[model samples]
Target: MNNVKNLNKWANAHTYLSLDLVRIALGVFLFMKGISFITNIQYLQDLISPIDKIGGGMFLIHYIAPAHMVGGIMIAFGLLTRWAIIAQLPILIGAIIVNFMGEMHSQNLLLAILILGICVFFLFYGSGKHSADYYFKMQQ
Candidate 1:
């Protein structure tokens, strides 16, 4: 708990407008990806075919789109951003695994890795000073 508090303090001290913009962009990207999955579920199924063969892929299919959609919104607004990112972590990890397990599309793999990296960064960084999290904290 002390470690988390210290990390949050360090992150808050390092907050910048550019980081906030990047967080917003990341949120929008994830949201769009969710929409894409919903619109073309077959594409998502194909991507997850390797996992599907092992079973429980159906559950993941259902979980991914909605989590991304809702979590993306939370992340964008910096409302419970850490929690939102936590929810997304599994999906992102699975995305990377699926790329390797199945047919590897360089583009998809790269995108997943990049997004995962950003997510991990934000996990530690927390929302910046410009975010709803900071605004609400200030209000309190």
Candidate 2:
């Protein structure tokens, strides 16, 4: 019980360090990928060409790119971080769905899993610095 108290004290003290760093890293990583999804239409088409070859409309592709980019920006900015992480789930899931399973190994899957883990972490524990939760704490 005493050990648990000490651990909790340490956690609360270091909250800003671990939480903010993770949030910033996650945000930037998502931002770059988001930009790629939005700006590089040809790339998106190439990877998912099977869908279109079978008659997936231009409309779906058009919307997906922008949505990915916008979602990335929101995550990076720590605006609705949980929602943004939740939003990214589809794009990664879609990649797994549309891509040949054999083409992906554990490495690729791990990256997706890692991103989801990061999102889940932030969802449960808000970015602790200069974030809405932090501000509220400061008020208290």
Candidate 3:
């Protein structure tokens, strides 16, 4: 019981800094992914092209590129973090779906899940103490 208490105290103490780092890393990753999509739009389009016949595919194609770029930037800067996370969630889920539907390797699924998990973590943690949100709060 004492050990558990000590562990909990340690975790609480480190959680903020750990999560802030996570937010920054996740932001960088998503931003890079966005840039990849922008630079290689045709290749990505080919990947998603199969789903184009589906009802929502058109919508996804239309919005996903911008979402990645804009959402990625927002997340990286911790600007409107929650909303940025929300915007990116659908894109990540869509990628998961596409990978599954394409019969890609299990590792792809794991990677997507890991990335999604990080996004969800930031969603709940609110960008921690090292974000634009924190800076804005300080100014106000």
Candidate 3 is scored at a TM of 0.80
**Cand. 2 Cα-lDDT:** 0.64
Better of 1 and 3 by lDDT: 1
Candidate 1, 68-134: lDDT as tens digits: 9998988888888888999999999999998889888889889989999999999988887778998
54-126: candidate 2 lDDT, tens digit per residue: 6754865776666666766666566666576677777666665555543555665677778767777765554
Candidate 1 residues lying further than 4 Å off, grouped into runs, are none
lDDT of 3 by residue, 21-111 (tens): 7777787777787788778878678767656667676577668777877877778787888789899888889778888677585886887
Q: Provide TM-scores for the models.
A: 0.95, 0.66, 0.80
* Per-prediction backbone clash count: 0, 0, 0
Q: Over the full model, what C-alpha lDDT does candidate 1 score relative to the true structure?
A: 0.90
Of the two candidates 2 and 3, the one with more favorable TM-score, higher being better, is 3
Index of the highest-TM-score prediction: 1
TM-score quality measure for candidate 2:
0.66
